[model samples]
Target: MSILESLELALKNIVSSKTRTVLTMLGIIIGVAAVIVIVGLGNGLEQYVTDSFSDMGTNTLTVTVMSRGSTRTLSVDEMYEIVDENSQYLDLCSPTVTMPGYVKIGSETITSTSVQGVSEDYFSISGDTVASGRGLQYSDMAARGKVCVIGAYLNLAYYGGNAVGQTLRVGGQSLTIVGVLAQTDEDLEEGGSDDCIYLPYTTASRLIGDVSSYIITMQSEDYIDESVAVLESALYEVFASDDYYTVTSMSEMLETMTSMINILVGVLAGIAAISLVVGGIGIMNIMLVSVTERTREIGIRKSLGAKERYIMQQFVIEAACTSALGGIIGILLGDGLSIAASTVVTRLMEETLTVAPTLSAVALAFGISVGIGILFGYLPAKKAAGLNPIDALHYD
Candidate 1:
């Protein structure tokens, strides 16, 4: 018989002991499944992080004014200098000033709505557009614009509905609400909506006692690195001290998330490796027992003139075939389980399960598991091959 045919016969013999074969395969099954699931989770975390950052929107950066003595060390002039120097370096720029107040209209009053004074270009930088009413115009901000933009939460809170074209009090000063912001969850979570109110920069300065707080945001598309460097240089020249006020690059969030993903992958791989080793040991134990049981058969074949090398090859092939079969099934099971788990997680959280184990992961896991089986199975095969025909055949 051809060597392959002999191996196939050995596999058939193994299959005759169906329960034993299945029990043996179980180790490989568990090992492969663990690898796939852990690897899949690692991939999932990476995608989830990326999605969160993308939702934050395009090349965005924030500059904040930090001051020790509350006499307003950083003025609007500094904001102008930063913006003017770096406007070409970015897509959009804005300054943010915040105040806390109640919005009062006749008998209706909404408390704890955040009020913000932002440049007219804040909407463009934030990728937000008004759902209704007009946003802050350049003309409006220049006149210390009393005109304002309202977020959806404001509509729900003060107006009990749409408050477009309605008048609200800022520091008890009447200001016309010119626009309502679009209802995007991200926008609301951000300072623009459910959490806060928005007003033109000039009007906010008028309402709050002339304190311009922070140089907030700039946006860009390409060459973000170059833009960040230039902006940093310009801001340094303006502030001259890192402690005075700081500019934070949006890329920090991305970098942190990516680092977290790499760490997770490493941790998962380590955990999965333990399971694989356990599986390998199980295979070895089973093969050793099989060799012991087949000792008499090895002696009988040897007595009939089978060479030691042939006997060794036969047993080794048997062990390898057993492992290869187990690896195949285990791999399929692992991948299937990973996909199912991902689906369930998505349904429960209402978030996409964005990571999938690449084909390389499956191939590598299965191949390694099979290789381990052969490696571990070698000792038992060797013991069977070295059996003395006389003693082995004479055994009961």
Candidate 2:
């Protein structure tokens, strides 16, 4: 028989045993679906984390005291020490002392706001565009000015666009709204929107009553390794020891996170891989039953001069058909679940995440399913083909 004829007959036999065929296919369908969902979710989470860092600006580097340095003492002078030495490689740097307090303007008062003291470079350091008011300037810090920049969240919260150029008291110190940073951050987790409210470092230091301790933001233009090296070398020279300061870079953090997620995705998919094996086993069992039931058919075909190879080929095709159908269904369902999962994860993170089914992934799943069917089904089919035709025909 031709390959086409063998294929047509194989499918007919499968349909004739509809319940058994479907039950055998269940394992493949579940395995494929699980693999797709697990892998897609892993890839999506990596993308979400990377995008959140990108949203913070790829060139950005945040500086802070390390957790291990918790017992160590640091001063504002040390912040200047890191910058004064590293200033050549750095595009810009600014120090911040966060003080969360209430803001009051006339009859309006809003609490839970994160108040910060930064300088002229902080706005551009963060790519925050002024939608309504102006950001702090050199003279603002020099003259010990109380001028401030507010994010749109605070603008809409305590006052409307009406807050522009209006005076608000933070911690009982008066500040004039000079500029408003663009409200590009989409997070709504309580004070997440209130990412910053800029006052001159001088003003903030005095208001917070602690100029010595703070967060510093920096910008770097080179590769992550180079940037970290340059920043560390300069900071070490400034501190004369590693005991007092810590540095964290966006590229470094994002790269580490991406690698970790990839490994996790692989491990998760590997666990799901056991299901593929189980599905392949199901296919083999069903194929063996098919061969037994069709013993007479096999003998009649052999008597009619059909080759053993042809008979084996027919059973293999039946195995592949079951897997192919399951694979198609699984891809559809898995893609939908992955999209929803990524969406929810991104929302929880306050950042936009991209999750799309990749062509490589689709091809891999389909290819593997079909390959499993063939590999497992081949053994049973070979036994059926080598059957003693005379006995098959004479029996039952």
* Predicted structure with the largest TM-score when compared to the true one: 2
Q: Score candidate 2 by TM-score against the native.
A: 0.86
User: Which residue pairs collide in model 2, if any?
Assistant: 133-179, 133-180, 134-178, 134-179
TM-score between model 1 and native: 0.83
Candidate 1 residue spans exceeding 4 A from truth: 1-3, 68-73, 98-115, 153-161, 167-175, 185-196, 202-222
**Cα-based lDDT at residue 107, candidate 1:** 70
Backbone collisions counted per model: 2, 4
Q: lDDT of all predictions, in order shown?
A: 0.74, 0.75
User: lDDT score, residue 395, model 2?
Assistant: 56
Candidate 2 lDDT over residue span 74-183, tens digit each: 56566566666666555566777777678776766766677877768777766678887566778887898978888777777666656788778888888888877677
TM-score of each prediction? 0.83, 0.86
